[model samples]
Target: MTWILVLVAIGLLSAVLLLRTRRTRQKNEPPLDKGIFPWLGHALEFGKDAAKFLTKMKDKHGDIFTVCVAGNYVTVLLDSNCYDAVLTDTKSFDLTRYSQLLMDRIFNLHLPNHDPVSERKRVNQYFNSSNLSRLCSTMRNNLQFLIASADTQNPTEWKKDTLFDFCYSLLFKAGYQTMFSTENDNTAKFTDVYEEFRRFDKILPKLARRAAARDELKFASSARKRLWELLSPNCFLTGSVTQSWMQTYLQHLKEQGLDTETQRRAMLLQLWVTQGNAGPAAFWLLGFLLTHPEALKAVKAELCSLQHLPLDKTEDTPVLNSVLKETLRLRAAALITRDVMQDKTIKLSNGQEFVLRKGDRLCIFPFLSPQMDPQIHHEPEKFKFDRFLNSDETMFCKEGLQMKYGTMPWGAGSNLCPGRDFAVCALKQVVHMILTQFDLELCDCNASMPPVDANRYGFGMLQPDGDLKVRYKLKKHN
Candidate 1:
């Protein structure tokens, strides 16, 4: 009996060792040109400069390369034709897994498990063009209130206040007002929810250490419990017609047999969808405008002319569209992240083969790189409002300045940001309100909005580092 037990234990140990060895071998066996210490991989260099790491690899290994990160092998695809091949291929790729990774990092919502059909259906309901149109009035009203409440004239106070903080606060207030309009008084409560969310974003990617990772998950769970408590009906949906409407909607969903957790996740999805990228994008637009006098002038001129246009008039505001488009192109929050799921071969227009392996990540970093590409835009570093203008065309065409791989601020294809149109409208209202009523200039002119360090993590997100002094000049009616 003792000899039989010993043999069984030996067999189990041997199997475990073999599995580990196989995984390690697979990790090293990726078919790509890996220069020096491929086992150590690009881990150290990537950790140092994640934004430039891919660019550097592209420089050394041409358009495609395979590198191991965190025990996972990733393939990067670059260059224009390769970009088109992946983006335009609708059926072959899915962003769900990558999107799930981001959701886990940011929201702690325990989402990303729904069937793709259901997920797409739900998201489409929320962000369909008609739904976005329904949101426009709410966004407009919220913007008006924010503008009326902003500290416009006090020069000294404005100078001391952080522009980034002000933008975040404005965005938070507007977002809350728009979503929970008379629905809840727990604006402060929701603010805490978002702060906790941001806290998780700041911490998650750095959780490579197992012990630290466990602690973060523990804290995140506790935060979620607290949030659930605060989000009780009495706290969140109360005291108004909108609240009643939301309650009815939720009840209908429950009657349709959606689980309680799914309902809660759906509510969370609504909250973040409204407040996420648009707010940061707005902040960046304003900050960038402060640096460029010509852009500011163009915006002011366009805004001043729009005073005569009716509120419902959508067309003829060409310059406002220009400002909005330029801002999105220049300073969008977040970058494109996709994992190459198949060992696919991409054929480029230049007659080169870019071979990509399964399970490798191709991250398109938007942190001051794409916006400053000299090859795409002449004098890329300068904030030229007309940089995106179709110079040869007599009419200002929206689609003409577009470059396939060059204009990727909102990403591309089916994964293209759903909230972009709504965001643009919201931002336009904000910019119009500010430019119309306020004389604005950088309060701390020396302060700059630079790329956030990789160690800190909140880069290309709602982070505008600057101070602006804005003074309200009452409109003169003749």
Candidate 2:
């Protein structure tokens, strides 16, 4: 009877503690949509359509709110007014934790907790202004070789092809050759490794599940193993090819005392980073130009002006530059995320402030926020080719404000992409080659713009849901 009495008292104490904890949470935390599930929370709703779901939430909950996704409360900042607070307060907010989580979950790679400052500095040097300028000719030559070898080079007849596939193939081949391998490297071997990489990339979102399932993990492991074989120092020790990015990175990893397996995984991560955005961006730029006749004509006129001029002066092609910028604004879907390292108050431009708790993630949806603001971008949904260009040959502004963070395709602040200049140069070179070498048109003029792949929202530029059919023939210049 004494033991029974003790158990009853313990149960009553537990109930009281639970109620007190709930009350404290209700008072301190931002409004969280727990959804219907016990712990799954908003995962289903978010996975179904992230952009639409977030938009609906923004309408109901204002700019700042929390959603319980997969048992974590993700605080989203959906207004450009709050961007400065996130960008400037690096001490309170950090990107490394979020990046590490993504690499661990999606890419199946584990990284060290410490900062890789030296490694980052070395990588940045490779993509500096001088190196990027020197690489322009290399990029152009690669594109030229691919185009000349393609079956579409026959000027006598138009060749039909899918835009995404064509762009992916061209960009992948050119980028891989230029950045990852030496001139004398075996093309067939590199192509095999690249194909495997694509397979792994396609299943990244499902990586956790696949890793648990034996059959799926088997395929993924085989692909990774083969990639390791190609990138390992043993294979390249005697090769005549000059050191590429991967080789240099491998040397760094060895100096840092990482095992071969870990080094290979790091190389894989680098490969994904280098190739992720450029291909999709190229596809959208060319695809949009093909579908919009007036825009195409204007850009073509701009291209004609550059006939006698040097291709090295990419900035001189104002119309093409504007088109690329506008495309980035329209299509790039990046989730700029930072972890709240300590409890802090964020001051907003609208004279409001919010308290962020430690261990919380502060996320900025670039697509749903500044990029789509009607005030910032008039007719935000429409593709205005020259929307970014001002009368004085500068970036457009909103409400007499310069709008520095209005459209962040390569992101902002310290975490901005190191390879932004290289990427832009490569993209410009690709478009230049296509415009100067090929006569291109959409096979179906009435085709609508393909839907963005919602699954890829936070993974750089979203790919089209379906490929656009296009026809091309060699352009005959007198």
Which candidate number has the best TM-score? 2
lDDT of 2 at 308: 32
Candidate 2 similarity to native, TM-score: 0.87
User: Which numbered prediction scores highest in lDDT against the true structure?
Assistant: 2
Cα lDDT computed for each candidate against the true fold: 0.56, 0.74
Model 1, residue 234: displacement in angstroms?
Answer: 7.3
Give per-residue CA lDDT, model 1, range 361-448, as digits (tens): 6654443334445555556555567655543222221124344454556655555655566666777777777777666667556656
In candidate 2, which residue pairs clash?
A: none
Clashes of each: 2, 0
> What's the C-alpha lDDT at position 447 in model 2?
86
| Model 1 spans with C-alpha error above 4 angstroms | 1-40, 87-91, 112-121, 150-160, 180-182, 190-201, 204-225, 232-270, 308-315, 339-341, 359-372, 390-405, 445-447, 450-462, 465-478
User: What stretches of model 2 exceed 4 Å from their correct place?
Assistant: 1-30, 113-119, 151-155, 208-222, 235-242, 307-314, 391-402
